[model samples]
Target chain A: MSGPARTPAEPATAPALEARELEVRFPAGRGRWARAVDGVSLAVRPGQVVALVGESGCGKSTLARALLGLQPVHAGQVLVDGAPLAASRAGLKAYRRRAQLVLQDPMGSLNPRMSVYESVAEGLRIHGVGDEERRVAEALGRVGLRPPERFFARYPHELSGGQRQRVVIAGALVLEPSILVADEPVSSLDASVRGEILALLLRLREELGLSLLVVTHDLGLAWNIADRIAVMYLGRIIEEGSTDEVLGEPKHPYTRALLSVVPEVGRLEPVVLTGEPPDPAAIPAGCRFHPRCPLLRSGLPDEVVTRCHGRALPVLPVQGPHRAACHATDRASADS
Target chain B: MGPGARYALRSVASGLGTLLFVVVFNFFLFRMLPGDPIGLYTRGRNVPPEQIEALRAELDRPLLEQFVTYLANPFASTINSARYNQPVWTLIGDRVWATLLLVGTAIVLASILGTWIGIRAGWRRGERFDRVSTGVTLTLYSMPEFWLGMILLITFGVGVGFVPGVFPIGGIITPGVDPTSLAGVLDVMWHMVLPVTTLMVVYLAEYALVMRASLIDELGEDYLTVARAKGLMDKVVRRRHAVPNALLPTVTLILLNLGFVVSGAITVETVFSWPGLGLLSYDALRGPDIALLQAIFLLFSIGVIVANIIADLLYAVLDPRVRA
Candidate 1:
């Protein structure tokens, strides 16, 4: 089948969300500061899936919160559909109605106290969608909870892990929101259940014409899900590009190391690095990745290292908007 | 049995056992007091040896016999001296409705206001509104119940003079009035106004404080965050989720307090001179009327048990997961 039909309703422009020079910080010891998200800027266009990839402590989730208005941005402007988000409480609430969150833990996200009907219909009720029961049933069917009557009256506890996650999706989609911020949505699900849930997310995005900000630590999870990927490290986006360019030929030393290690199952490899990621509180001067640079894997692996010697690596464009935070050579193949 | 019903049974059993232990301890402690109840009844002046012997035999024999009978049957009947040739059960059966009406109105009022104020304080916790509610509750909670009654009396009764003891200032009903009649009912309510108001304010404030704490704790739960993100307004969220969960703990406290209400709010009862259970209990205590005292004790225990059972049932209804 062809992609979604573009009605006359399709807006002239499709910029769903935009952030420029975004910054978020926390108070550190004795008036010092930690830059959680510093001068970071990105756009999540309508109908585009931008997956924010990072390790556990990276600021992808923070970025998601900031974008969703769950966490306020300290030093940047957040624009949703070309409207600055800070002005109206009512308007912001309206914007929130347009943008929803699907939390990480499938098992824990839905309230145990609420029935599947209540949980899924929560959005419809808030938006004052008419015929709430019919809408709930429709949304449940859309999420593949077939024979919706069987599930609607049941509580979250009665549903399996996959069903619970779909309930979350149904809740968000029932509002017909244009943007969905799925923050590690399937990370906590069993490996077997993860595929079906991910496929459901992909199908919803295609059918509903929804823009997605999918945050995940798993590169493999993002592999089939995102059109583009943004890799984060130490609370900053160190590398970002189209998924193929970033994953196929990694640029950032950290990204390279991360990619080199993804094939094995839970393999912790000893790799070259200047040092471990500098403490967020005491960010090393110059490049944050300087200490952990494999360029210094052994006594600073020959100045052959092009980037991450000890300076902020530029977001270099490789090909077709593909970018990384390193000027380093692909030393693995080079050494070979 | 249903899970909730089972839990309720366990709780009620524990509460009754505690009450039984307390009664036994208090009964023995009353016996240890300085003056003998029989001696007090005899009064100070000496009489003929036969007269003294006869009075002692008549009073002491009854008191000992009554205590033993109470141990055997808590619901046993005794004579009501206030109403000549009437049984104590007769008084209890008649007065219970009056007492229930008075305290029941007060309990309902207290719960509504307490929960509302408590939920508000909890919702925007640390805000000025929260601070104000906290302040109001604190002042009300600390104000003695009798003192509150007196203040209400002075304001509505004495100060404005519109009411001007138009309501019964004290005692259930005025003398020569039938408590069962419409006029008697009016008089009871008139007396009830000050005491119920006093108790409502005093009772509500403590519960509000407790509820505020519980709701505030509930607000911190991840479930509440999910609800908020679902775009539930603060009020609906608190009422639907936070308030109900918050009120769970307060149910037991309020149930226990129900016993206190029927046993007596002596000070408020005295301040209003309301002829309610509290006044009856206080009088019984002073008179060392063994039958009256024992009856009051038994009545208080039964009231506590009933209130607690109601609380359990209510908890089950409010929270489905408990029943599940």
Candidate 2:
């Protein structure tokens, strides 16, 4: 597939997009709030692909929205090119032109009434960019819709799932954004088309040098395309690192439980934790993952076990090449 | 044939079938009534035997023969009214313009005002303007059209105290003005003020409520969120994306209402004493005027059928999915 030849080591250049300590809360009917996304700090370096992976309701999608500036964050700043994102209308409009979002469901994302040309030209028209016809044609060509005029007047329902996703990507690419935030880009397509769409995204990144922040629950997708992977649980990043480091040597119990089920060759017996998935509204005390942590049940030392049930771990540092938020990892590092 | 042409052909063919059915129904509807047409026409006057014989000859023909003749030319001028003793179409033609002028004005005004209000109310639901406007429209919608008409007639036609009655009390025009002059046109519009307002209020409330509900449904659609993310202005997103899609269902409603323009607002026209087809129907019911009633009923049915056809074609034009 000719994937980008990038190293896992931290790059010296500034990030194309960065979110620092971002928190998004929604009202839970009473005085309490559900912390959908809490204190998430992540960055995508120039020409890098970072995948945010987690199970459903783990706040991964919420975190993606916050990074795109589509969802209002209750706390923390979203920095673009090392400058805090502007709150003004003109600034946000300009920011959107530089960073576009590719939504999960292409069928629902494109207006059914609008034709392909109109949908792709919408961003340019909004910004009053001239030469709409040529630009729209170029963007369509870039997304593999060859001889774009053949599809210009077509509606969303006329195209297959993969084609619709391509049109959505074309709509975003027409703005010439440097960064693309794709939330479950291929999850809604058929299994046969998923690989094709993923390959197209990778090709776009290579051809345009565009940084990508892909959000998905599939660890295999991360292994295939992402250089870095961030694992979230109950609205917090429990572990993150290079895909090789994290997948080969998972530190947190949550990450280990997740990777155990990835359907790999000669994989270990799956670890099935016996508890309901964590709830963001009622996160457990001590460690949020302690309720489902297999290590807690595996008979750790008394002192370490006591700390696991009573103390909350601090947030991971923003500049780590590989990091995990777990007490056992901390004690093991101390011993080493 | 292309899908567009096929759809249009199907719509028109169905409309014609419905019209033929209505035509047959109209012929038999009065014949099946209990009263004798000759007896009803000659209740008080002492008539000669020969004249009575002639009346019976005209109406009491064999059922199959009468049906064939009626179907041959439904609007034949020879078909005279039993009550007015004039040709039925002449009577209808005189009142058709007045009814069209009054109802046409009301529908146009109501659709525009109601749709605009509905779009705003639905887009900002649960807010102050939405709550207040929704309540007002619901109240108007539930109120009876006749009662509302009478209230308007009394309040504006016959002023109570210091508020003087400015508009004409009744009739389509004032007496002794050149009927074809510009003054006569203004007078007719002035007379239409009360009846038109009454119909507009009731119809506007309905349009607004339907439009509001439809728009609220469209608000949650993912396409609107996508448009907002595209960095379009909020107003552009609403007008260009949300409203056009929402207007699809409303187009059917508006065209269906247009079909009733021929029937006119019966209660509103009667209460205001405007000389439209509605009032003519009300007056004709006094004698149970069979010929006039038949023609008017047929016209009403034709109006609705044609309207349904237009709605189908227009819907296809507005929504491409329907074409497929």
DockQ versus reference, model 1: 0.26
Estimate, for each residue in B1-324, the C-alpha lDDT of model 1 and write its tens digit: 866668777877887787777566545655566766545544454546786576556446655674575566656563343322246666666666656766778888998888788877888888998999899889989988887888787777666655454454566667898978999888767767777888788889988999888877777565565566666776777667666667777877787787666765777777776667777667766666555665677778777777776777777676656665
- In candidate 1, how many clashes are counted? 17
True contacts kept of each: 0.24, 0.55
Give the range of the ten consecutive residues with the poorest summed lDDT in model 1 chain B: B77-86
Best by TM-score: 2
For each candidate, what TM-score against the reference? 0.73, 0.91
Q: What's the C-alpha lDDT at position A317 in model 2?
A: 60
RMSD of each: 7.0, 3.0
- The positional error of residue A282 in candidate 2, measured at the CA in angstroms, is 4.2
**Candidate 1: deviation at residue A160, Å?**
3.6
Best by DockQ: 2
lDDT of 2 at A72: 90
